[model samples]
Target: MHSVVKLADAKRSPKWTDSQTESGSDRRFSQHASDLVLRQVAKAYRIDGKRLPVLEDINLTVEPGQFVTIVGASGCGKSTLLRLISGLERDFDGEILVSGRNVTGPSLNRGLIFQDHRLFPWLNVEDNVALAFESRRIDPADKRRIIQEHLKLVGLTGFEKAFPYQLSGGMAQRAAIARALVNEPEILLLDEPLGAVDALTRLYLQNELQRIWTQKGVTMIMVTHDIDEALFLGDRVVVLQSRPGRVRRIIDVDLPHPRDREDRQIARLKKEILADLAGEH
Candidate 1:
């Protein structure tokens, strides 16, 4: 069960401040829609009395309202990096800051979605989404409105009572997305959210994800193996190298939204990213 401090309440909650005083930079806050800064971050695991490094020197700053996509080969720690930012793993070295404050643990301000739609098999769509609001203290009317709005945003408006198994793969994923959004998180971290669906449905959901991003104006960071998907959806693509994953390059997608898959720039960038991935072998 996930917990949340309502987006509006979080803004005013004294427990979480409105402003963050970074080491040397000017103060930043959630009103700016949340900015994520990671510096000198590294992670390792100990096995058989030996230390095994998984990621090294991962440094990035995602600005408010940006869609940053991360692509790399397996074992490159793309998902591990996402976990660090999500505050699910805190034994890492260095720092992860959200709006200038250290990310010590998971908060309602950051929502996470995985490849599998981890919906409760016993719960219907509305009930599963309603779980996000379990700890929120808002009025019932407001809670209902939030759930309805997010469902509509994900185009699952009429399937409010449908069970997860009853819906198509795409629809189930949409419900998962709605659950993530119902909290009104300022930053959404997705770990291959569309990986389980068929290719055609994956393409369609990319469009849906773009639309939702536009509607909510939240910062999004996603990890994927699909080069075309990365180019199609990201404002910027960060490529990583394997064997102690490290950043290789970050490519800017200057094209406007509803981007053309056949655009010359997209094609060129795709080739470049493919070459980069191949080089990691």
Candidate 2:
């Protein structure tokens, strides 16, 4: 099961500060404070006294609210890169800095959503999302409010009582997204979160993701095999080369959000990316 580490300082109050005007109708989640920077990051594993490299010399920077997507052929270590960023794997070369501080382990500041929903089969939507706050010191009322706000953010407002089995693939993914966002993470790392859904539902979720990203202003980095999805949602796309994954090229979408899928530039870039992927061995 996915979980967030508790806030380091137990005495510090919860960051979800709520204030009300006379009408008592305004509520907001705090914006993230840190941007992500990775410098010369490389990882390797040992197999029977032999070293196997996965990622090599990865250097990238994500602005505080920018959306960056990564694309590559299989075995290029896209998911491995996300694991390193999330601090799930610490044994690697180079440094990953967030706000000039090293990322040593998992914290609530970064949230990761896998391709699978990973929701507990027996837990309802509400309970699954609430799992993120299990180790938090937040008040019960505030936690409840945050859960509801994130559920509404992902269009799962009425399905709070539903279990994973009760939802369609798209709906389950939405619930996964909501659970990932419940902690108001500084950066949301998605490892092919939309890969399991059907075509039409994937398109709809793409729009929904953009809307949520616009509203929340959380920095996002996603890895996907879909070139169209990468172009439609990314401000920049980083392509990787296999055989000890390295940055092959970084293409700037250079287009605004809510981009049209039919844009000529997208079509042109798709051809280029396809050729690049096809040429890779």
Candidate 3:
């Protein structure tokens, strides 16, 4: 299920403030949608010689370039699921496919963003973003150009020279986003990328993300604790239950871009979803 919303009216919960933000965000939301398929994926962890299943027989699909959010109680394998798909951890059962290709290892085609902005403190914004392209033997000039373009795409143009230490939480996260996009990964895996930010900054970053997704058309799978965030950003929001995590429900947010905060249907849906998550009748 999927719903389009008015992009503007969507709730912005930024985690930071006081930074010159982007001139524009890249959103490649073509009318033509695509999807990623996860088939019967299961995971287990080894602890003290015991095998503990973290996830079991899970299956889900995210339309190509669609923004999908997974929310559930902690220890439900949200991050573990992301790690498997990102190819960080391959010790799992079931097939993880992106665009019909089985994900065996981390490839330049897939990008992963973590809760912490993994920017190198020594490197400036531009360099950090450009580092993503270092695997290939490219001319310095080309790499530099790619970095500049991606920084601008993530709205961090002038801060190219700013070190991670000099940036606010939101700014650093934006820089991380810029780096993630530098390689032009077909799918992005976010493990609570915005969880560490403040309220205001998180709001702004949310809007920035929408703009980017709408422009880039990259398939995104985000794990979030905030139900509202999931509702606002995902075409389909998947709620999971604990104890061998399973999908409790999948709801399609049927709104249009430039979403309205006060839209009656949106508010009602949010309330209903919240209630359902709360185990309310």
Please, what is the whole-model Cα lDDT of each candidate in the order they appear? 0.85, 0.84, 0.78
Question: TM-score of the candidate numbered 3?
Answer: 0.85
Q: List, residue by residue over 120-212, the lDDT tens digit for candidate 2.
A: 999999999999998789999999899999999899889999989999999999889988898889899999999999999999999888777
Worst 10 residues of 3 by lDDT: 11-20
Mark the regions of model 1 whose C-alpha exceeds 4 Å error after superposition: 1-32
Q: Please tell me which model should have the higher lDDT, number 1 or number 2.
A: 1
Give Cα distance to truth, residue 76, candidate 1, Å: 0.7
Compute each candidate's TM-score over C-alphas. Answer: 0.88, 0.88, 0.85
Flag the better candidate by lDDT, 2 or 3. 2
Full candidate order by lDDT, most accurate first? 1, 2, 3
Q: Judged by lDDT, which candidate is best?
A: 1
Better of 1 and 3 by lDDT: 1
For model 1 the TM-score comes to 0.88
lDDT of 3 by residue, 1-281 (tens): 03223322222112111111331222333222234788999998889999888998888987556688898877778998899988999889999887688989998778899999999998888778878977888888988888888888887889988999999999899899888887778888899999999998898898889888766667788999887788778877888776677777888776755466677876887787677667722
Runs in model 3 deviating more than 4 A are 1-34
